[model samples]
Target: MSDSKHSGKHDREMLLEMMHSTTKTSAEDLLISYKGILYPSVLCCLETFQALETFEAREDDILVVTYPKSGTNWLVQILYEMVSIVHNKEPLLDTTMIEFGSPEILARFKDRPSPRIISTHLQFKNIPKSMFEKKVKILLVLRNPKDTAISFYNFHNSLPPLPSYNSWNLFFKDFISGKVCYGPYFEFVAAWDNHFNDKTMMAITFEEMKVDFPTALKKISEFCQLPLNEEQIDLVARCTSFNSMKEQSENTHGKLGDSFFRKGEIGDWKNCFTEDQSKVVDEMFEKYLAGTKLGKMLNYAKYCKW
Candidate 1:
């Protein structure tokens, strides 16, 4: 076998070993490593990032980037609708995420026509360099880390490959310490913050979208140059509401038996986090992001309600 194939085989073996072990402390230990980044599985992110290195980028391509469980699906669908409006065609683009590393999906992506939309959870450093060179428009979504942690905790418990925590306290401890998959949340957000000033990237908060849907949609449309009016923006907001998406998600992915939309609310961490856990997370947030834009926007000190 060629060296690349051999290395891919070895990576899969290592991933299986990690998944079989049950007593690991850090979630990183449960992941396979590639290019110095940890992934929940080797089949998806590791190989996707490897192949993505050479994937061509177009000037009009749109990439929706976000951390997991941070309203990625919601934003992607909205973007699709906006694209449909611009082209005056039915939205035929499939919104299934390509980060899972399916060859069929990659083939479709390569063969699909121009102005394609792709989604990823990769850090800014790990994305394809061609995207930067081509100057594609990137939409990034942010959520409070506390809520992100809580939602991700619940989401991972239902997945078999990831470590399952019996209690929120145990998960909270790991999450705060940057031990969970795609974690070190502060670092992830901070890394992306480097590109906040780049005109190619537009950053939006999930809370902002939730509170003022029409305004947020207009901002997104303006950023992408999709040119939607007030009525269209209002329609997109109503169509993409949590309740509407929840129903659609269940109907489409019910066979997967995973809950994709659970309690889509801000300040949800308040219900799961104890006073001690809240304080611990707040301290860690301040330690890692005391002076960053994300830190200021999160305002963990004022909203953690500890």
Candidate 2:
């Protein structure tokens, strides 16, 4: 066989293996290789990993980084408006998460113009080194662990090939133990938090963004050096509000799934977590974050009660 044909055959075999193995009953069966990294065996495949590694970075690239279910889509839309205003461009740019393993994101990014705004759920360590070396801007958004866990529980239940915990108790246990996809919550937050001092990175909290939309927009604009006037900032805030985004999700992005826009409110965990579950999460938070600067900074204990 020709070399090109042989390569195609090999790629097909790998993809088939990944899909077949990913469908297994246990979570351990779902890992696949990409750029030598072990990614959860879910929506992404080998091609997705290759695209992530091969993706080139522009000097002005803006990355929106977050743990899963932590206000990524909301922030991306807000940043999208800021970038659109700055460039005065038409047919707005795509801001899909790189790690989503979407081929469309790969295609759009490869050909898109400079000053691209991309989002990702990859751990800080997995982000492309070129981004760091070039001092590209990174916006890290975090949420209190309780809300994040509840949001993610609903998210995973909708996605197949990822174990759907029928019981909240099982899901809660898995979440506290960090057995889900994308690894542990504490580690992901800490890895990015360590870069808080980097001139290129800015961290924001979901609760803060919820409480103060205009302030969040102002901070984000300034962090990216986009400098929107008060009027423009107000416009962006109104357009990207949780209600606005949730209503526009389907019309704007096509079918984004029911869970994607779910309860974009702070403290939704109150409805989901029982007294015992809340306590378990509190214990995990204390155990994992104790003595760490991030722990001191967040003081999650203040928000422990459901």
Per-prediction count of colliding residue pairs?
0, 0
- Deviation in angstroms for 93 in model 2? 5.0
Those runs of model 2 whose alpha carbons end farther than 4 Å from true positions after fitting are 1-42, 91-93, 102-108, 290-293, 296-299
Q: Compared with the true structure, what per-residue lDDT tens digits does model 2 show for residues 117-154? A: 88888887778777777788988888888889988998
lDDT of 1: 0.72
TM-score of each: 0.84, 0.82
Q: Model 2, poorest ten-residue lDDT window?
A: 1-10
Q: How far out, in Å, is residue 168 in model 2?
A: 0.7
Q: Stretches of candidate 1 above 4 Å error? A: 1-30, 42-45, 299-302
Candidate 1 pairs with clashing backbones: none
